[model samples]
Target: MKKIKTVDAIGHILCHDITKIIPGEFKGVAFKKGHIVKKEDIEVLLSLGKDHLYVWEKNEDMVHENDGAIFLKDLTAGENLDFSDIKEGKIDFISNKYGLLKIDVDTLLELNMIDDIMLSTLHNNFIVNKGTKVAGTRVIPLLIDKNKLTEAKNIVGNKKIVNVVEFKPKKVGIVTTGNEVFYKRIVDKFGPVIKEKVEKFGCEVIGQAICKDDTIMIKNAIEDFINQGAELICCTGGMSVDPDDVTPTAIKESGASIITYGSPILPGAMFLLAYKGDIPIMGIPGCAMYNKTTVFDVILPRVLVDEKLTKKDIAMYGHGGLCMNCDICTYPACNFAKV
Candidate 1:
């Protein structure tokens, strides 16, 4: 690119977009790249405080920002994602479906390490709605060394840096295990709570059972739900170490493979996760009934996506597992755990 006086720039093509800001009214590109500069444009440019203009000058080793942004977009965009039209040397990657946003953080970091190349994204494993801006890519300058973008592509090779995993609808079963609720001494609040949480993810509660804290009864309830074709079973209450709290023992006795019995997160440390064949069963503590967000919220989305959780996955929650319990709960948006 070559810089010239605005008056001398007439008839030369602009190498970069010129932004125009009209205080509160507008702020966007007024003159796009490749637009031939005209005599009448000088007065308009001067009003925008432009004394100089950059004219297009091709170089084999350098790439124009618009093309560079497209290259970056092609390298990073993955499944269920769409790219916005390039504007001002940048393009936004939007979600094409409502699902979990997965970011290849290692590769993303490597791509951003390349100078003059940028790829910014939302937190990995975040639940995003369709049309949500998942990521954005751009070149730092109007013209950048082609080698820089090439290096970024090489770093992000083969694997997608950003993608969305759509949630699969499942038949959920609720097992409210506590003597008080089972005998109608107290109303069954856990079932309604679990129902609301699962329904938001597009799942249906196919069956529910109110069982006393008897291990055998709890086991039978879980088996009954499975026989009824429940893909996911939630056992609420009776998760603590108290002798009467046999929900965890019941989950094991039901022949489910236990993944993790305790989480590092507060208000949900007693949580238990297991799977019976392809079915996932969770033993939820009392905190889930009171806390708007807990370990249950931390792991529910992942489960819905059929992402198996390892002990290490649960252990990592220690970093951001404590809930702030703000006056207005903004969960999922807040860092309750590392997604």
Candidate 2:
């Protein structure tokens, strides 16, 4: 840093914040740190009795914070993501569509490890809305070493540190299975519950069927839904190992490859996932009808984006998978799972 005459400081970066105070009216930052001295700023500085200003010295190895922030923004931004203008050497990434937010945790960690550089983002693999701020990046100092920025770029490489996977509009099918519901012995609540959840992702239920605890009946319903252009099918209830529970077997018999039959989560441990050809299918547990949030909520957003889930991916939910069942639930924002 160096001190220069206010008149000559134009186009230089300010090294520290300049305050303006009015005894009765207001007192706030007149010029913030990392602000570039504009032509019009000279008069304001002169009127404030600032003849000399401390500014960042031009150096070959150093980069102004504004430039550093842009570098970080370019490295982190991905499809369906936009960035805000730099403010106080910080830039925020915003989503351009309602979808799932994905972060490259390994690459982000490497970028943050560089000295004087910082990047933070929302948790990976969660739902986000259009215009939502998902991440922020900045430099720790008013001036940072140019080499640090280069190292960050190298760490990022071709990988996007932050991105949003847009949700695809899908025709969904719901298969409400169980003799109680098919026999009308009890009201069928699972269909409505599953429909509400599907609609939240902007998907529509184009076909639905109420089936008894017979594998063949459920298999036929699955085939009928596929014929009706259903891209995703949700089979509710009949997931347990009981003799009456045959949804999982029905899904397999329907030519669908089961991804997982159960998860390491409470209230959703009996959940099942499968795919027939290109269409995804799920066997939702009974708990989903009563619980406000479950593994279904965690995985629905990902499925809407057409993400293929593997058994390993489902197994990872073992960490932070149990729901606290807070009286006042705040899902998608709470630590129900780390997916």
Candidate 3:
């Protein structure tokens, strides 16, 4: 049996001799045996009433002439199959003789990490019953084994997945630093701005305090939140390089360890990350309040899932442009944040 190269590939049945098949004027051309089907040629074949081909079903014997291998059913036919029913590990057919196949949901979702050359390396797709090959795997399409991909899928299932831009329950603490804001010489508008964004994440502001540029005061307020069981902490103002822009220093002055001080993202570039044991402390810049591109948006999702962020992770946001405050913020739907 030869290795099959593609995931989700389908084949069709050849009804006649290859040489005898006539190519219509509308049809691009006729194909011969052993001719690999491709993207461009698929439509031409479809127009010639060729629907099924010898699809790679893992078992060489199962790949009858003209069987489509990738497409399982006609989506336009209003017929849909639930992948959940297909089980989490192995690609199996309950009552059919289709040899066992491996479908990895994680890699498939993660930008088709497998390539054609690797996909061509696997041979079996249907051979086991549901749950029989719980860790069902393959190797024909590429170097990645089905077992590893299956494991990855299981990992995804076990972890708490968080989708950004969607309102989810969160516990937040706002630490407002700077003498001016702390002394109330100017109304604390920063607090309200942080509050609005926090509410969007379904966050409840459990701990809040006004601290002068003094590091000890800011550190104490952060500690209070940790003692009170705050999952996330936001420190607004005092983020610049000036003598008074001391939020970064304050977060470090607290017991929390800083993970990153800068990010590639606009509006939130001056953000800072610090962790104490497990609690996260964030230093949000003044830009966060006015530009809507503050550190809060970039790291909030990672905080929800407890992911550790590095400088490199923060650098990935540069591809997307600054938020234009468009009428509709179709994030997650549009990946506007581009994190």
Q: Pick the candidate with the highest TM-score.
A: 2
Cα lDDT tens digits, model 3, 191-294, are 88888876765579996799999988888888888778787888888888998777787788777788788766666777788788877778887787666444
Q: For candidate 3, which ten residues in a row score worst on lDDT?
A: 72-81
For residues 245-320, what per-residue lDDT tens digits would candidate 1 score against the true structure? 9898899999999999999998799999999988989988889888888888878888989988888988988988
State residue 330's C-alpha deviation in candidate 3, in Å.
3.7
Best by lDDT: 2
Q: List the candidate numbers ranked by lDDT, top first.
A: 2, 1, 3
Query: What TM-score would every model get versus the actual structure?
Result: 0.86, 0.95, 0.55
Order by TM-score, highest first: 2, 1, 3
Alpha carbon RMSD to native, model 2: 1.6
How many clashes in each structure? 0, 0, 46
